[model samples]
Target chain A: MERVISKVTFDLAQTSLRQVNHFLHRELNSETPKITLLNPDGAHNLAVGLDATIDVEIMGHTGYYTASMNKQATITIFGNAGTGVAENMMSGRVHVKGFASVSAGASAHGGLLVIDGDASLRCGISLKGADIVVGGSVGSFSAFMAQAGRIVICGNAGDALGDSLYEAVIYIRGQIKSLGADAQIEPMMEADYQTVGELLAQAGLSYQPQDFKRVASARQLYHWNADADQEY
Target chain B: MCGIIGLLIKQPHLRDSLGELTVPMLIGMGERGPDSAGLAVFTQTLADPYRKYSLYSGGKDFPWQDLSQALQTQMSKEAELQPHGNQAVLTTDLPSTTLKPWLKAHYPQLHVLSTGRAIDLYKDAGNPTEVADRYHFKDLKGSHVVAHTRMATESAVTPAHAHPFTAGEDFCLVHNGSLSNPNEIRRKLEPRGIHFETDNDTEAACRFLEWRMREGDDLATALQKGFEALDGFYTFLMGTADKLALVRDAFACKPAVVAETDEYVAIASEFRSLAHLPQVKHAHIYEPAPEEIYVWNV
Candidate 1:
């Protein structure tokens, strides 16, 4: 016996984002899967707060907070995504076929956010434990204040790549204009290469891991002291 | 929070659809700012010898015809007043320097939204759709348009407090974040003969830029100086007679997206505001870096 996949479609032009989100919450679960969102038309807060192992596809561009706080949902945006995509996600995957605006994957705990095109400023800002892979370039402050996670960029990185980073690994294949406070470029070991290779493979990218540089925190500025203010 | 949208048509053929294209963008930002809305339109038709001034009378039905007759009598020149709901556009051959002061000295109640050779402004405190309909915004024709929906974080909601603040002739600015040090800057500029109309912090930024320009700095230089002087988390869209400029604060907390096509350049607080634009899918979309100035010339 074969199992049937339940697929639901919602057109945002005729329906509100709230109604779509409500339908997603009420109908989506581990048992019933798949939703097709049409005519997103850059609406914000679409498919937010999803905690099921379902497949959600958005046909067009979306505004802020798209697929934010996702626990276990495989979401794909066919078009561009606005600010804060997949922010604070716990699990599953979110893929963007087009460019992502500022804070593409900010403060996510766990998930795989794959951006096919360039990501704007603060791509992985305050990231906790997610894995982000960008197929194209990323804007400045790529991993600012990231406590934990891994970010792999197949292309270049903008200024101040990993500012104030902590316990997070950043891999960039192209040039890094500048590094932020307490962030330093480290020699990639064999294990680090393997990690980058795995992240690229998971994001369905074919970049070579040997052509990348690893950036990590120096751990010197972890603790503050009033007496160490001579530079100020 | 506030919403900002700007459209500058590069193709001469698409210039007539500026207002029709801008209404949807402004309305899309209704969730971000539901308090009031304002817009400024620039057309080539207004490039004649006459100057146009857009004025708001605080929702009052003022004697616009009488004011126009008086202005014609006093200035000894032809003047025309066209009213639209609570706002009106006054066109005259008088220079802004003479006309603005005269209007200020006489009708203090009429708030001048903008004055320029090619710009006309309209704004009010209400829903963005209702405000746009009241002024027949969909029927307006222009080469470029800049619109704002205000949430009023720093000041009370009034017609005077709506955005697209005009400081210099043909120059207007709309802000999306709060300024931390406006009063201090206001006090500093007050002694230099810079007059302020509203207590809104955005007005302070507008006046500061105008003052910088008055000091012989070009628009780009003034904006670079603004990065050093202004303190806040802001994304600003400023318009001149022939250009549109954008700048974000160093922190880049506020959101802004810029999309450019061969036919046009559009900016908005979010991507949704620009999603309805023509051929936006093929447009090159990106976010401006913090402290970077992006300017588009006509």
Candidate 2:
């Protein structure tokens, strides 16, 4: 038997979130590759911790940690997403067609996160290793203490951008309000341009890579210096 | 974490369903705030010298008619009482200085929730849904509303400690985060004869802002000063006689979202509470920025 169902409509209005998530976790097989969630109604933890390769579509707005700890799946939200949309994902892609609240991809280890609209404050706080692309502006304290990976911002960035940044690099095409301690604007090289171009294409945005500026760690605060007296 | 919600209707017809529409918003945040709830609503402004006072009797079954008779006989004024179980709203043209002291001397157990020409407040130590149903929130009519559901991180779980704290007249504030320097704020205002109510941190902020307004600073300026004076994480939503205001601290630790339409302006700590609103799918939704005072007039 082929045993393949092309599309499944899981209406959250008639069913409980626990049943849906349980089915995704326990009963769903590779044959059930696609599931559409209707009437999400801003519920929390809608489809978290999935290890299968599947397509999940959320019809409406979602609460915090909607697709956190995701693996081998593609989750899409047609409406806005709440805080920490894809936190600590191991692998996969989460696409938010609408705006996102604070900490959009916080502490994610690996994944591709894309936002079509603006992302609020601390968009990628404590990010480990995730490539995030934003089509619109991002709020303050973005990319704070990000240890690895890259961030692509197609629009302006708010205050204290890339604060205490580590290895992660931020490429912004718009104006910068202010930069945080030990984070500075650097000249974009050939590799930087290629990286920005590729990430922008992945995020489905077409822009001139030459117009963007690269922001990265200055490496001054990497280790403590005894000679300096509380100055960066 | 606590939950904060505010709704300010722009159209005159929308005010009729203010509380009916707000009940769902309040209950939607039950996961974040299941301890206690409070709300301050602003209705049509009364004429000069006329005010409405919201009183809570602490879950006691008292004769509200007897209190009305005493108010008429002792103070020699025509006052009307509309009771809701343990709660009542007393309307009169009497001065607060004259009536408050009389009430204090006569019925000491009654807690004065709020007093102003256009405001009526209700709060209790119960679930948000229970509190709403108890006060018949579905029937409330108002131009603007400021509500809070408390989880009590830094205070007790008593009705006195609930939010939507008021000071002076026609102004109320609800806070979603804790304050770090309440004692410092208290040390500055106590000498000026500003009485302290509950030891809750929100009370300090309420008194401080009310004092600044009393000193002739408008709500926006007072909030600018609040940015410098108050230290801690806070997302404050406030309601006045003719306006609704919101602000967040510089750190922006707390969360607040605004959904504005042609008919009304709605604010909540999260989008969940606002998902079921009318025409919300088309509402202009955005999070409030840090250190910005967003004021919408009724």
Candidate 3:
């Protein structure tokens, strides 16, 4: 069968990448579509909520919700992305070559989301299955309310990262503000570091695995007792 | 919303006595999902059939007596069904080999499904205390469990979609996060005669596991494939009859923490979930590895 998305096209001059999504929805019948964003300056939601076999390559910066609710596609944002990039994505790969704004990849489920640059507040907030590898720092409340998966922050994190979280895994190489809710800092053994190292490598991020510290929940928030008037 | 908890022990002594430990643990998590509570207990029976006990309360479904009586009559005989106001319980004794068929025959209303070696489930609309009081969780004890306290974003508030669903024998799951590819996966699985009860995305995860299991993939391998195949945000806790496992989506948008020592290992959405444990001395907590799978054997 013919490849889902075979041709490479650019709509920078055409303006309104809306047609791109519409075209993709019609043409690429696969769960993921192979796309090439040709230096689009201000495209918003270039590939959000597309559940086909598709791969997207953005050569330039993007606007909000670049890949929200994505499934089975590989998205590469060659330049910076605006607010809420990859929000609530389900399955697929999202790679930002440059910085991303607040809530990048927030609440995403199963998939690999890699950010080559720094991210703003609520990065990965309330995140579910998504695995995030940030090459740079994360803003406050990273992985907040996170239910599962791994988030490796290559740089420092802002205040209250991982607050009130459940079972998500986090690894950071730099300083962090107070841990939120049940989150805690833990030592990284060789076996653990090796696993972290390999995951980072798979995300195409390079760093000294030893330099990172691991963050997780203390398992306190999973329960609440009314008679005791306590919240876990 | 509803509350759920599943545990799997590594040691045989711990496994056999799981009922004792799990009864209280489920009650402890009851507050997180207070709207309704239910517990399913599994015991190993090589000679006899696999045994499953389910206890829950009918919170606002109808009057307490009416709901309880209906449940009791529906789950009578083979499964001991008891309803007490906001809580109810059901027990079934079966051989391990017949667990799958037993679940299919008796708990079809639950719409059970599996994920890797663990079962996946959904519970809607209940508080932890309400769940315990309604489900009679005090009577439940098992080697392993995985539960949830639903905020009710999607799906109904019915008991049919509650957490700790069973896919086959000895498997259950609790999850946090949304699945994006449920329709696609559902469309694929429905043709295979795999039934569905609710509209929740987690059912896709269960069907994904069932598909992988049918293909002869081991639990861990199936989970890894789930990591690659399923789409959406998910940080899930799963339990077999004798083991507990955790799986996170690639983004890790949600949070999961683990506190461990030589004696016990506790996982939760927050530290307070395990803070009640008296044995937790200076608990060291950390997040699951990205795209990682953690298993505790019983």
Candidate 4:
């Protein structure tokens, strides 16, 4: 009753961000189960490069690259993120309870990012082998050039969604502004519905799986065409 | 890279704390731009036949009292000069067409930073904290503010090259990205009686917009022309006597975040600079869309 059980607090306003990051990088065991950060106040590089499976809860807004290159750790942000949140993550989960700036979950090899609010331009740009579920709308150029992964957006998609995509699949439940080069709208199949269902269930969304449209690459840019007179 | 910050006070009571809130925002951006910093504050507009001119001596030992006395004797009007080290604000009941030529002939070393009834400008070549402290930015009271911290990518690290560049009265602009067509814009404007003081690309943008405003185009129209004429990436934050405007280029490569509360609207190149505002956590925060004009009135 005196103190919160199984939790540690690091007030960023009282201490430097480097100390908390150092602890996350070098220190931490079963004795410390959950680490909570207070007054992040748009600080960059918080809880990055963590290989351990610990619970991290950030209290306030964060600057760029929050929880980047994360592995096996479950990190959650209570406020908005600046840019590139959970970028290049290997595994585990990163969730933003609020809106995110550009390039959220960018170029992650493997992980899951669940954003409850909208994401700005270039969300999941150049993504690789990560599962991202956005509850709200995504800005322009979402999932551009994504090589391998799955992005499920529950709200509207902005201009040029999934440009020049490869292998990665996008399921959006709302209107599309336009699609980029070689990114085509395709009919949803049984596997696509299952993928959306699993991702949405994990992201805590209850939307019907049939309400989504699938976008994938046309694969026309995969080979060079010399006889077409430069028109694709 | 550089940083741009703007704050527009929506409530009248919040204007008194404008400087106090903005000083930390400017200092927070020091990491992005350490070479030079500048700010333009738009206060209550004065009546007709009186204008406040922000002047800089470039050094700490300028004889401001002597200049004041000289102006009082020569102009036959009550001229008051508020002196603070190298910076001074000269309030006169004469048009700049008369005062500017006189100052040019009398004191050539003095650089007129801004000439308007509602704007007081401060800029220098130094770190953002040092520059704000040197100019007493925490003491500035205004309805709105436009400020910049420069990294010296397109120009030298001189005070003249610092941002929040002003052209016509009561209008100023700060840019966060470089312009590829500044020389071309300069070539088009120089023949049209628009003067440029530095080779800075942001200066080209500032003058272009002000010239459009002077040619009877409103802020929105001028910005539309700016989009068609200016090339390259940018996130511009502009301030007028009664408004604060923000716009990004088509690519939106340069960053800008806005936080809007009931009392104030804060814009910065990044969220870190805007994190210290009062009630910012509860404010409606979002990134501006590309090629869109957002204007907040004072």
lDDT of 4 by residue, A1-232 (tens): 3543477899999989999999888877655479999999999999999998789999989999999999999999999887899999999999999999889999998989999999988989999999999999998999999999999999998899998898899999999998988899999999999999999999889999999999999999888889868785
**Winner by TM-score between candidate 3 and candidate 2:** 2
Ten-residue stretch with the least lDDT total in model 2 chain A:
A24-33
Candidate 1, CAPRI quality class derived from DockQ: medium
Q: In terms of docking quality, how is candidate 2 classified?
A: medium
Worst 10 residues of 2 chain B by lDDT: B249-258
Show where candidate 4 strays beyond 4 Å. A1-5
The ten-residue window of minimal lDDT in model 4 chain B covers: B76-85
Please give the lDDT score at residue A190 for candidate 1: 99
- TM-score of each predicted structure versus truth: 0.94, 0.98, 0.48, 0.97
Clash pairs (backbone) in predicted model 1? none
Candidate 2 lDDT for residue A116: 97
Model 4: lDDT of residue B186: 99
For B1-298, candidate 1 gives per-residue lDDT tens digits of 9999999999988878888899999998887889999998887756556888898887468888888888878878788889986789998888877988898899988888888888899888889988888898888887788889999888999888998899878889999999999998899899999989889999999999999998999999999989888898899999888899999997788888888999999999988888888899899888887888899987
Tens-digit lDDT string for candidate 4 (B1-298):
8999999989998888999999999988999899999999999899988899999998799999989888889987678899877989999888889999999999998999998989999999999999998989999998999999988887799999998899989889999989999999999999998888999999999999999999999999999999999999899999888999999997788889999999999999888888778899889998898999999988
Q: What is the interface RMSD of each candidate, in Å?
A: 1.6, 1.2, 17.1, 1.1
Report clash pairs, candidate 2.
Answer: none
The 10 consecutive residues of candidate 3 chain B with the worst lDDT sum are B113-122
Q: lDDT (0-100) at residue A177 of candidate 3? A: 62
**Native interface contact recovery, model 4:** 0.58
True-structure RMSD for candidate 1: 2.2
